[model samples]
Each structure stands twice: as structure tokens, then as C-alpha cells.
Target: MSNEPDQQSETTTKTNKPSIINVAVAVIHHKDKYLLGFRNAAQHQGNLYEFVGGKIEPNEHAEQALIREVAEETGILLNDNTIVKLGRLHHDYGDKQVSLQVYKIELTVEQYEQHKYCEKGLEGQALTWVSKSQLLAGEYHLPAANKTILEWLKLPSTIVITYPLTHFEAQSNPKGAWLKYHQEKLASDSWVYIRLKDSDSESVAEQLMKDRPDILVILPNDNEQYLDDKHFSTTGDTKTTQQVVAKHLTHSTLIQLFDEIGSSTASIQSLPKDYPLIVSCHDIASIKAANQLAKARLNHNLPPIIGAFLSPVLATQTHPDTPPLGWKAWADLAELADMPIIGLGGLSPTMAEKVIMYGGIGVAGIRQFHQ
Candidate 1:
């Protein structure tokens, strides 16, 4: 609820009063566990479980304040190098507005061993280390600080795309860029898809999978017996490379798969909930369509789609004629969508910092990693 417009629901009655408080929130994570503390019962929204952090004082940078807050609230000390940017949230609590920068603290073995039991109910706020599962379940009943943080936490920050053979016919490499890129990227934690566009797609898929069986191999409607755990079947069509590669669960597609006769209606309610899905979205209409599909799926007790690839964030050679979405447009559309999205087209891994700032999970591209 942090960035959602409905954040007013969390607001207190003192809507006339005005105050701006900048906070640095630390999601101090060690493996599967994260540290959280109870809020002071005397303060507004008292006794609620929330991440450990404190207000940023004048002249202090956000990261510096996070380090100070963690050391003060808990015995564990942290430096700028140990912190990773998780996300940011802005909450308008009626009278007082709050801007919070969230971070994940990376600790060393020695630090964990020394400070594992070093924290207490400092300032009369109880502290507990909870597992990831407990955090996901509504066990903590976490305040409206950053509800979508959990969703972003479960997803990776990068998505890799295979450079379709045709796109690179004009260029060449020593060992072959496509094959070499696969070798280089497979070492990371990013999700990858070998876009089924080549003339010998089946053969290309085999070689790529044989080289790195971990990558998700996307091949249109047909499924092969050898495609055991590697096949990423789609809820959309596969007539063209873009259509099949993006795996769009179009409204019609959902209607065909999930809609019923009689009083029933067209909806995406029947789409697989647990299965990993990555849908392509080019503009606002696509984003809205995805949102509608997600709403239907949620009504059926399904989780939101995993990732949306927003294209043309910058003008690119892939689709040179399409107008650019730019950063603001991309951010606006992404905020409207229900799930985590990746900024695609004309971006490198470095764009991840900007992508996150613009409300996207991270960056994805076809040629960036390949080069």
C-alpha cells in the first residue's frame, strides 16, 4: 500500500496537520530470515510489526542514516558496502507524509555469529527474526509500509533474452555470440528464454538446452518429450516469434481457455497460478490487459503474473519505428500494472539502477548481454 493511491486508508484522522518524515528502512536479511521489530505502542499505529530503521536526520544521506539506525536499534553494525537497494516507498499518512528507502543488509559469518543474539527489545519494542515463509503468510500483519516488497523479494532482478539468429545475421563473432552469451549469462541467477524464431528453432533449442539445461526454452504450442523441466509452455499463441516468445495471455486466449457457456463470462480465472509466467507488454493498453487478466486470476486464488517486459523504454534498432515510452511513461504504466515488471529494449545491466528507481523490478534485453 506504500505507493498505491489508496494509501489514504492507512492515514490517521489528523489530515489537516502537515509533516514530512524521511525514513531509511533496513530489511536486515541473513539467509532465509529477516529482522523486524515492533513499533512503540505509544506512537501512531503502535505495536505493529515492521522492519528495523529510523528517521533520517538533517544533512545525513539515506544510506548513512540506515547504518546509524541499524547500529542504534540493534547491536549489529553495517557499512555502505554491506547494503543493497531493495526498493523505496512513499506513504501519505494524512497529516504526516513519509518517504522510506528500503535496503537489505548483507552480513558476514563472523558478524552473524557475534550478533545473532545481540539484539533486545530496545526502546521497549520487541524484536524477532522470522523466516521467509512466516513473513509471506499474514503472520506479521506488517503495516502498510511496503506491501509489494514481498512480491519483489521473491523475483530476480534480471531477465536474459536469447539473440534470435536472424537479428544477428549482419554481424559475427569468434565462437558465435548467441552460444557465447548463453555460456556467460547461465552463470548468473537471471531467467532466460531462447526466443523460438530461428529457421531451425527445434535444433537451436536442443543445442542451447544441451549446453545449459537450466534456461527456460520457449517453443510455441507444440511440446516435445525431451522438453521435460526446460519447456516454458505459454498461455498465448506461437504463430510468430514475438507472439510466442512473449507468451501473452491475450483476453481472447483467456476466454478460450477459461470462459464457460451460460451465465459465465470471459476471464483469465483459469490460468495456472503456480506456473512461472512472463508476459510481454508494449504499451498502456497491454499493461491494462495484463491487469485485467491478473484480476481474474486473483479472483481464482492465483498469484499475480511473474514479470512484464515493457518495451521501447528507449528507441531501439529492434523496433526502430515504435515511439519511445521513455522513463516517465514506463514508470506510470508500470505503477498501474499489478505485478513486478522489467524495462526491456535498449538497456544494459547498468540500467537496473534507473529501472528500479522508475518502479520496475530490473532490466531485461536481447543484445545487451550477448555483446
Candidate 2:
């Protein structure tokens, strides 16, 4: 597949191939639809769909390149401030390697109303606004490199990390308060990371999974409880029966896995492929480790790393003694990550936009989510 949809000719190969081509991609959103362009059969990865964007110029930053490309191809001038970072993706087609600097632009209502019906591209391509559901369902065929980006696009901007069950039970209506509160707090199609540390957390997770099949519930990777014989049993209410539970690994568990596996590329496959994995990264080292693990799994065509949680972006009451990473430090570390980074700790749903602006794909928190 071709990296540039607008280029009419095949790319010339240099004697020494460059490491990778850096492309700027814009996921222009207006309400529930995203602006897309159809590449002609003559073009590379031709006759398929693509987001509106092009190659980054020598001195141009990703945002600048995206804005220029979008304007050139669609005749829509984009404000630089409106571009929000959506992390990056690196993929290899054997013939070509590309690193996509993906960004998101939420169009104003006026812009959408004016251009929503436009089907003709300013360039020689067909422009269309595809619904998010259509994209997720694979109705529009995108390039192979866009697989992970599309998956990331499906994620909600805010994820609720549940407080321990005990905390919820302490309330007046202990019998059914926690489930009711969670049901109310979580909107349809939202995500919740269950963090209960008690013995019954698995049973509680099973209930949540059954009740809210519309939502995604991620369980912590507790070996003692989730790895025992019952977890993999064929019958009964095992995590595997209803659905394989996605796992969230703490920084320590991630570190341990990385160390135990060493550099054997095949060892990465030891991590279960039946479920998605999310790793918590508190520092640059942990981020690097998580990236390594993700790269290894990608080589094996395993389930992609859902995301990495980078915490303490801001100080909170629970951990006052530990200084917050602040936005600058958090962004620096986040840039090093291969998977989408979710900014956690001292963050609220309201701050999700800011988190994306600072290089995170989403936001996660306990008390803030509870509120």
C-alpha cells in the first residue's frame, strides 16, 4: 500500500533506504462522522480509504503538515490550535516503513453543516464522511498501518478506574450501592478498569461484564486469583466463559515479565493473546519496557497493547508526599511510548481534553471518576 494517497507516481527508492517515512494523519471529526478520502486504483494502496493527510516537509512539524495537507486536499483550512495529538503509530509493510503522527480535529458545528454533504474532494479524490460505527465495523477499508490507530480511535476519551469495593460498600446502601453507582457513572460504550483488591473482585467483575455488555470492563492482572485452575475452566462462571477478561498490569508486574522473558523475541508470546493488555507506567523506564513488550507482541501478531497508563501527572490527596510529574515531564515520557498513553492520577474527566493536548490519548482516575 502507498503511504501518500495524493501522489500520482510510485516513490523512487534511494540506494540506502531511509529508516522510515514520517507522515502526518488527521482524523477530522464532526459529531459522529470522520472525513475520509478514497485513493484511486492507480495510487499506492489504491482503491482503498484513507484519512486526509500527507508527508511532513523537511522543516514542518506534524500539525503544520497536517493542516497544509488537509487544506490542499479538502480546501478546508484548519486552525493549528484545534489539532489535538492522538499519539503515533509505526508499521512496516516490508516494502515501506511508516511512522504516522496521528492527530484529531473536532470541527465546529458550522463547519460540519457546511461541508457534511460535500462528496467531491478539492483534489482528484472522493470525499466522504463515514460514521464511527462504520469505521469500527471495517466497512471502510483503511491501510494496514491504520489498524491500531482505528482501534485507538474507538476508545473513549475518559476511562473510569474503580475505587476498591470496600470504599463503595462503606456507603449507606451497602448491598447494591456499588453496582448502582457504577451503572450510573458509566455511560453506554464507556470503559471501566476494575481495581478491587478483595477476593470477590472477580465475581463482581463477572456481574459487571454480564450487566453491561455494551461497555468494556478491564480487570487487574492478579495471578493468584485470575491465573488459578478455575480461571481457565471450561464450565461455570469463569472469566473465560462469558468473555476473556482484559488484563491491566501494574508497573511492577510489567517489569517482572520483561525481566523474566529477557530478549527472546518468542518469549513475548508467553503473554496471553486471548485478552488485551494494559500496562501501568510511572516512569520512562517502565514506558520503555512496555513499549518493548508491545513491539515483541506485535511481531507475533498478538493482540495489541490497549494502552499504557502514566500516572501522577498531577498531585492528589492520596499521594501528597510524592511530587506530580506535571504536564511537561508527562509529555516527555509519553512521547517515548509506542502505545496510546492514558494520563492517570490527579486527573478528572473534565481534564481529558487537556490530557490529549499534552500527548495522551485519554484520561483515567479513581476519585475523579467516582465523582
- lDDT (0 to 1) per candidate: 0.60, 0.75
lDDT of 1 at 313: 92
lDDT (10s digit) by residue, model 1, range 10-75: 433465454556788887777877877776555555657788787777899878988887777776
Count of backbone collisions within predicted model 2:
2
C-alpha positional error of residue 346 in candidate 1 after TM-score superposition, expressed in Å: 1.1
Report the C-alpha lDDT of model 2 over 62-171, residue by residue, as the tens digit. 88888888888777878744776666777776656677888878898888888888888776678899999999889999888777777677667888887666776668
TM-score result, candidate 1: 0.55
After superposition, candidate 2 runs with Cα above 4 Å error: 1-19, 166-188, 222-245, 257-262
Question: What CA RMSD would candidate 2 show?
Answer: 3.5
